[model samples]
Each structure stands twice: as structure tokens, then as C-alpha cells.
Target: MKSDMTKGNIAPILIKFMIPLFIGNLFQQFYNMVDTLIVSRFVGADAMAAVGATGTIMFLILGFANGLATGFTVLTSQSYGARDENRLRHSVANAIILAVIVTVITTFISVVSMKGILRIMNTPDNIFDYSYAYIITIAYGICASVFYNLGASILRAIGNSKVPLYFLMLSAGLNIVLDLVCIVGLDLKTFGAALATVVSQGISAILCFVYIYKKQHSIWPEKRDWHLEARDTSHQLRVGIPMALQFAITASGTMIMQAAINLYGSVAVASFSAASKLQSLITQGMPSIGQTMAAYAGQNFGAGKYDRLKGGVKNALIIMTVYSVVAAILSTSLLEPAMYLFFGSAENVAIQLPWAIPYIRFCAICYIPLSAIFIFRNMMQGCGFGFLPMMGGVVELVSRAIMAALSMKFMIYELASACDPAAWLTTGIFTFVAWLYVAPKIERMFSGRQKVID
Candidate 1:
């Protein structure tokens, strides 16, 4: 169902909207987490590391697409809030066109660079072939991932987060079934896991596309809405490129961190990979909150309800803070069992637990700062304060790069683990400061409008 967040009780509406998003993100992460689970448990730790090895590169490519899709949806949300169906319709169509263009380019580049990227990251020889097989297979289906991300993002922008959750649940189930069939039954190994992910995502993308094509409502476009408006395209790129750069910048930092992690050899890689997956599962709440804040901020900003937007930010911060605490507790509890699940309970594999535990704990501790960064940065983006978020991205990049360099130079792999919290803390500070600077200006702008109307 469609929602008008512009006038509702801020906290309830935001919570209701975010719950499905939170669930959907869990299922979405499961698409890969399942792959890792099945591959590690059924195949081996090396296989798990192979899948894990692809994470940063995939993040670099798919993260950019997701960010672009998210940036495009800000326009849709604002338009929906303003009840400007024309703008919403045009933005949707143009955004789809842009997604198609970007998907093609990204897929091509990723496929071509897969092996080279793995080599540059210094993928260990034992896992190199497995990593190549997994990533190349994933690269082949990049369009599916990008399409689903764009389609789902557009839906949420219009206050229909539930539909995407339904789609993801379906896709995730299918992925698990395929994982069993391919990895267990057929014993297809790493390639099978990657193929399962692509095919499942493709199904979700197709389903989402069909739904939007047929809906023809407020945010969905009809035949008449299919034309490309140069103005809309320009606006999309203007907003989207910065967001995309922000994601790419952040991913590049992770890429650096991954390279640093790779220097430690396969055991370290496998442990880090497994631990990273668990942390990702725990930290889903941060992104869910950010996404909810984005929609809330966009809608209220477009409706010129600056105070409502502020209220949404405050409520979202509370939500994220509570979630961060819960996540830290859960992560600390599960980190051990999760490692056993991934690397096996075998005696030889037990040695990796010592290395993995500290990294996972560090990540869990960092969730608090991460929550602040995600909420503030995404809120800024949704309110169309694009530059601040972009600057926050820059902060993230610099902090991680610096930390990773120091860690690698000193051979303190644990210090490499500290990079995440450091980046989150620095970027959170920047975004918080930016919000402080900008909130008053927005209030003044709207205050003048209210006075004129009076």
C-alpha cells in the first residue's frame, strides 16, 4: 500500500516502513550469506574464502549501482510527497533507462577485470581458481543484481517497502534450494554457489519489473511516461553520480582493506571472510535505518515539512542506537558458533578461531558509530544535501586508506580490523557537523515561505 509520510505520526510511520526494509535486507544478505554457509559447510573453508574474496569487488560494482538507484529514488519520494505525479513518473522511467545503461557497462568491466582484480588483491594461490570461478560467474549476471536493486529501491521510494521484502523472501528461498541442489546434490562447488545467487536475483528482478510495468500508479509509469526527459536525466545524474561516487569511494577503501587482509594468506582470508559475513548479518539494521530515513527525509522535504524531517531524523537515531546495542550483543554471542559453522569443528580449523574472534568483536563494537554514519549520511542525501554526504564518503575513504596503510606497514592485522570503526567515527562526525550547519538554513528557507503564505 502507498503511504503519505508527509502528514503521518513520524515515529510509527517510519517504524512501519522500516520493518519490511529491515526484513528485506536480511533476506537480501542471505542471498550471499547462504552461499557462504553452503559453500563453507559443504565444500571447505577455502571454498568459503573464495566466495568471500569476491565481496569487495562485488561491493565496488554493485554498490555503485545500488547507490545510483537510491539517489534516483530520492526524486521519486520527493515527487510523491509533493503529489507531483508527472515528475515521479518521468524520474522513474529515466532512472530505469540509466540503470540499464550502467548495468551493461558495469557487467562488462567486471567480467573483464575479475581475474586481474583478484590478482591485484593478491588472492592466495590455493583459492585463486575458486575465486575466479565464483566471481566470473557472478559477473555474468551483474545485470540481474543491478536491476533488482534499482527496481526495489524505486518501490521503497514510493512507500511500498513490503513488496520488495516479498520478492527477496522468494529469491532467498530459491537461492537456498539451488545452493543445496548445486553445491550439495550436484557438487558443483564455488561456481554453483555463484550461479545460484545470480539466478535467484534474476528471478526477483524480473518479478519486480513485471509488477512495476503492470501497476501504472503514482510512482509507476505507463506507456506515455516512457519518454526520456533530458532535464530529468540531468537531475538524476547530478544527484546520483555523487551518491555513486560515495559508494565507490567507500568500497575502494574496503578493497584496500581486502588487499591488506589478503597479505596474511588463505587462513586469514577465510577467517576474515567468514567473520565479515556474520558482521554483515548483524549490521543490517544500520542500512535499514538509513534507507528508512532516506525515504522519510525525502518525502517531508518535498512537502516542505522541515520539522517533520527533523523529527524523523531524531526517531531514526533512537531506532538505530537501540539496534546497534542489540546487534553488538548478538554478534558477541554468535561469533564463536558462526566460525565453527563456517570453518568446521575439525581440530586443524580450530586455530583460525583465535584470529577471527577479535575481528568480529571489533566489527560489533563499531556498529554504534556505523549506525550514526549511515543515518546521518543517508538523511543528508535524502534531504538533497548531497555535498555533505559526498564529503562524508571522502572522510570514509581517507580514514580507511590511512589505517590500512599503517596496519599493513606494521604487520598488525588487528589494526586492519580497526579501520571500520575509525572510518565510521570520522564520517559520522563529519555528517553530524554537516547536519548541524544545514538544518538551520533549511528552516529559514521554509520559514520565509510560511511568512509569505501568511
Candidate 2:
């Protein structure tokens, strides 16, 4: 089931690897959107906005854990590329240990600090309790999010994207059913949506772990593999910490933007939330291609296939450019209908459309830079250059913070909406520039002309 990216036609291999990733990503987003739809319809707009308001803080905490899991896999992907079974198994073991440590720490911190963090985000009075209930429940289930991401990242590392897709599809279906049962049947409201997400993710994690146990015996850790070594642990943390910081830093910027949005009241929050989800669904291709590049570049880099690495990046850019155009077209075309679907009523749509439509359209036209952010950032990470992407995250944070600050001062909806585009543009340029600096050094290291430390 493991497809090696170090062989075969570059475009076809990448495309084949990318399809499952895209579909899996789509279903993941679909279920998330379902959460919002059900919440809005059954619990009302304020409830939907309450869930939405927790978005950035959740991203800040959960994104950090997910990022660490992803960074841990870079080494796994590399070991797989080098055909180092012993090292690959060690990497997997260390990753599991690290994931456990992270889960405990993040869960405790996030759960304890949930209410204060929501308050800091300027959550409106009407939705404050709802936000607390939703996010706190999600925080309690952080292990589910962490383990699922770790499992999926490990699968992708070994070039087996299909298995995770299958489990995720199962998770999505279960989530929809649970969302209805928890929200409507049990009258749990926002907490039900969060609980459904956590439980579904937990199921996917268990299934993914089982699959890896049964099928990936070659890379599975033995008793010896579980004995942690300082060098291996250090290596994993070197990549994982920076990657986690990158996600945390970027989420902080969004947290700032969310604060700005909160000032605009519940309607703006709900509209922005709905529009953002729609954009994410439409633009799934960008991240999918980025993830493909991560594995592709990781495997090729491990194999010392510099030309193939370069070729993969080139091919990815072409694919992403074409996909970005298609995504932009789809976002613009689907705006009205998508808004209607999210709110489930024309009356709600009429109120939110004026704010949501332009925001989505603006983001659609800026997909190229957004595409660049994903491709180059993941390419760098895949190539064992984690620090560069973390710096790129700083660039994103600064851009969003400045935009959010300006939006707050001016009291303008347009400025608030501009936060994402601005951050993408800035971070995209930074990552591409970082790549130019790192690529030559990678080639030199491969050529034995220079020594590079990852």
C-alpha cells in the first residue's frame, strides 16, 4: 500500500498521491461545515457564532499539537525514503511518545484557560457561555485530535494516503449522525457539535492506529524501538517544536483578528465564520497539493534526489496555479448558494450576504499567493527546513496583527476581511524567498560540497 515517491513520473505520482488527500481533506471540511449548519439551524445564529468564535483559539492549541505531529512525520518520511526500517520505526515510536506528552500538556492548559481565553477574545455576552461550553469540551478531547493527526501524518509519511481517507470518510459520516443526535436529540446545543467532532476524531484515530498495526508490520516498533534515545528524541523535537510554534504563532494572529471581528458583533462573527468555512472547502486543493509536496519532497530529499525534488516543486506549482484558478471561479460562483446552505434560510442569508460575499470574492482572487504559502512552506518542511517556515509564520502573524489592528481602529469590515489575504501574500513571498536560500544549500549537502544541519 506504500507508494514510493522517489520513483515514477513526477506529475502522475504526485497527482495520484494528491487525490486521496484532497478527498480526505474535503470530507473533513464537509463535516465541520455540517457542524455549523446544524448548529445554525437548530440552535440559531448566535449559537453558530459562538462555535465560530472559538475557531482561532482552538486553532492555536490544536494546531500546535497537529503541527508537532506533522513535524514528527518529516523524519518518518525521510527514514522511509532512505529505506532505513530501524530508524523509521524509532521515529514512529518517538513521535508517539511526543504526541502523548503534547496531548497531556495542551489539554490541561487549554481546558484550564478556556474561559479566560474566550474572554480575552472579546466574546460577546450573548454567546460567551455557549462558546465556553463548545471549546471546553473540544479541549477535553484534545487527545483525539492529536492522535488522529499523528496517525494520518504517519500514513502519509509512508506514501499511504488512501487508508487515512477511508477512516476519515467513516469519521465524517459518524460525525453527521452524532451531530444530529447530540444537538437535537439530547439538546446539548453547541457542546453537542464539539462533542460529536471529538468522538468522531477519536474513532478515526483508533481505526488508523489499528490499520497501521496490522498492515505496516515492517515499520512497526518493537520493544527495542520503544526505548527512547536522546539523539532521536532531540531530532524529533528540533523539527516538531518549530513546526508547533509556527502553527501557534499563526493562530495567534487569527486570534487577534477574531478579537477585531468580535467587536463588530455576532452578525459579523457569524458571517465571517460562514464565509471562511466556504473558502476553506473551495480551496482544499491548495493544501492537498502542499501536503503531497511535503511527502514527495521528504522522500526525494531523503533519497538525495535533488533533481527530482526540484521537479516535484515545479510540477506542484503548475498544478496549484491551475487549481487556484478553478477554486477562485468556484468560490465566486458558489458564494450565494453556500451562504444560503450555511444559514438554511434566505432571511439569514440576506442579512449575512452583504458581508460574506465580498470577503469570499476577495479571498478567491488572491488564491495564488495562498497557494504559494502552502506549497513552498510544506516543501521546505519536507526538505528538513522547519525554521524557515516558522519564520514565515512570524511574517503571517505580523501581517494579520497589523491588519487586525487597523481594522479595529477604522471600524471597517473590509479591513477585517483583508487580514487573511494580506497574511497569505506576505507569508507566501517569505517562504518562496526562504526556499531560494535553502535549495542551493540542500544541493551542496547532497553533493558533498558543504555540510548542512537541519
lDDT per residue, candidate 1, 1-454, as tens digits?
6777888678899889889998999987867788898898899878888888788988888888778877877888888888898898888998898888888888888888878889888788999999998889888888888889888888887788889899999999999999999999999999999889999999999998888877736567778878778888887887888898899999988888888888888888888887888888888888998888888888888889988978888888888888889999998899878877776676745878777877877777777778888888887788777777888888998998998899889999988887787888888888889888988988997899899989
| Model 2 C-alpha lDDT versus the unseen true structure | 0.91
TM-score of each model, in listed order:
0.96, 0.98
Q: For each candidate in the order shown, give its overall lDDT on alpha carbons.
A: 0.85, 0.91
Per-residue lDDT of candidate 2, residues 16-45 (tens digit): 999999999999999999999999999999
Model 2 lowest lDDT segment of ten:
445-454
Q: Where does model 2 exceed 4 Å of error?
A: 449-454
List per-candidate RMSD values in Å.
1.6, 2.0
Clashes of each: 0, 0
lDDT of model 2 at position 336: 90
lDDT of residue 203 for candidate 2:
99
lDDT of 2 at 310: 87
